[model samples]
Target: MLREYLQALLFIFIAEMGDKTQILAMMFATKYKMSQVLLGVLIGSFLNHGVAVLFGSLIGGMIPANVLQIIAGSAFIFFALWSLKEDDDEDEEEGVRKLGPVFTVAAAFFIGELGDKTQLTAITLSVDAAHPFVILLGTVSGMLLTSGVGIIVGSKIGDKIPELFMKFIAYGLFLVFGSMKLYTSLPEHYINIFSVSGFIVFIVICSAFLIKPIIDKKKKGEKSSYQKAAMTLHDYMNQMKSNFDNICLGENKCGHCEGQNCLVGYTKDMIKEGIEQGTITNPIETDSREVWAKKAFDHAKIVDSLKFTLKYLMDNYKDLQKRDMSNAIRNSLEMALFEETLEFHGDINMYLEHIKEKNPFIMEELRKSL
Candidate 1:
């Protein structure tokens, strides 16, 4: 039993890397919290694979193997269409979108995994295994481990990839995977019209969606300039945090706190090593040099905005950590956005308004931080 569990866990973990479900997790992480997305992946994978294990263990001989294949394949195709169909709307035809981030993610992942390969593979893996429970637990654990990487990496580079392009890639993958599943699941005599045509039509629609945005931008000029600025501000927060900690390290009063992740100590060590080696070539530390001083100073203003935002996160980390970190970080950045000259895009404006209304005290706190 122990061996079975370990094997299932390790096998599924390797299988899920770069899988469509992983991409789905990454997409959600950009807009939702890490914890929320991680929870959803856990529930989604467990439930989906539990059913597979049941089918494999109890009814493997009863059901037609081809029928399961067709069902899984059809599910993938449906999600392909769904990938492009969903917009950035806060409210949709279903209540799932309005149920809040955790529920929304759970629903999305649950639905997304309907015909997923991982679940289908679990069904095969459990077919002759004496330990069904271990199989289920292992599959779930494997998926969570893979999805965790997606969430972390997504958070780091989410802004760099435009949302529409991400959607395009997702939809395309769905079309390919679903089509292949259908093709293999069916008999040699069967033709897959849905898989072939669905992929073609969706590709055309995605092309239109992608092109329309570029065309509109060319005609209107900088329509999303404000939102781009917002993206840039949020993207550089980690770097700014490091730089801010370095400034604190330069102070004579700075002291290391044991057991804590000491940014000050880390910065001091880096600088001292550079001085001793005469090889300090970092952009952030190039200040006091005549050639690089102005560049460093211009960059400081950007970091200043980040400092204000981080102070807000640090001050309210308790209340904010209860919810998604993404929301708290973005809400804090709203303060920086107001001090700028650009206008908010409709989505950001709507988000800011919704957040303020929901967390009145937070909005007030943000204002005071600025």
Candidate 2:
């Protein structure tokens, strides 16, 4: 029993190194209490492993070993393929009710453990051991330890690791396991060729799904850049306003600036200070003090535009982050800054052009200075 327990623990520990359960734990830990999340994961894993052990014992009693091996291998391959095609959006919703850390963590772990490798490992261990309870406890403990580590460490590791690389590793592991099962089941057949062909087909299908989205996003980014570059000052300001308004009034709340104050309010304060401190430089070109005064009075309009743009960025930031578009938030902020600066320059140029037409002497004097 001790030997069987240790073996089950070791196998499960290794198998769950970077599994979806760990990933989910890490993700939940970032938003909820780690203790709560850990509790949830423990409960879920315990239940899952228990079920696997019971099912394995029953099946072991009824089925032939060779047939069971083939079925397990096929299931592993199918799951790997499914994992490769899994969408980030389908996982968990952000900011929905705050489930106490324990409950949330446990729930996430339970859901994630369904038909997972660790569960399968538990089943395998159950078949090998005389006492299934030992296998269940060992596997559950191992899974809990791994998932606890993930929750404690947070999602930083996941952020650093590329999803594609993880997917490839997972596929490779599943393929190896599947081939071993196939070899065991059909010793006389050409199993290597069959396994290799299946792996290739799996890779092709995954590539088709993953590559298309990446290409589409790249194209969309290029188009956005082009549109930004071509926008006039008035149009740019309008866009800024639109972006800000979206942030303030949109359905999603910005994680960074939620509860106390809206981003729109924050931006209005920033603009007000910028104007009072004379840091808010206008793009309009004008030499006359009278024209300068008029533009300065238009500061109200500028404030309104800033509020609109900031709100939009904040709202979109929430959406993008929820969608696992981490870089998108930063990119959108940078784009907003660029458009703001361009609008400022355009306004100054508009004033300067007006001055050049109405007061050629003043324009000539300024041109000479340049």
| TM-score top scorer | 2
Q: Which stretches of candidate 1 lie over 4 Å from their true place?
A: 1-48, 51-61, 83-142, 162-173, 184-199, 202-370
Which parts of model 2 have CA positions greater than 4 angstroms off? 1-20, 90-99, 115-121, 124-131, 152-154, 190-370
TM-score for each predicted model, relative to the true structure = 0.39, 0.52
In angstroms, give how far residue 213 of model 1 lies from its true place. Answer: 9.4
RMSD of 2: 14.3
Task: For residues 69-151, write the lDDT of model 1, one tens digit per residue.
Answer: 67656765655555544232121113466767777777776776666656765775576567888899988888888788656
lDDT of 2 by residue, 1-84 (tens): 888888677666655655556666655554566676677777888888889999888878787777777777776565456545
Q: Please list the C-alpha lDDT of all candidates, in the order they appear.
A: 0.53, 0.52
What TM-score quantifies how close candidate 2 is to the native fold?
Answer: 0.52
In candidate 1, residue 181 scores what lDDT? 74
Error of 1 at 202 (Å): 6.3
Q: What's model 2's lDDT at 57?
A: 89
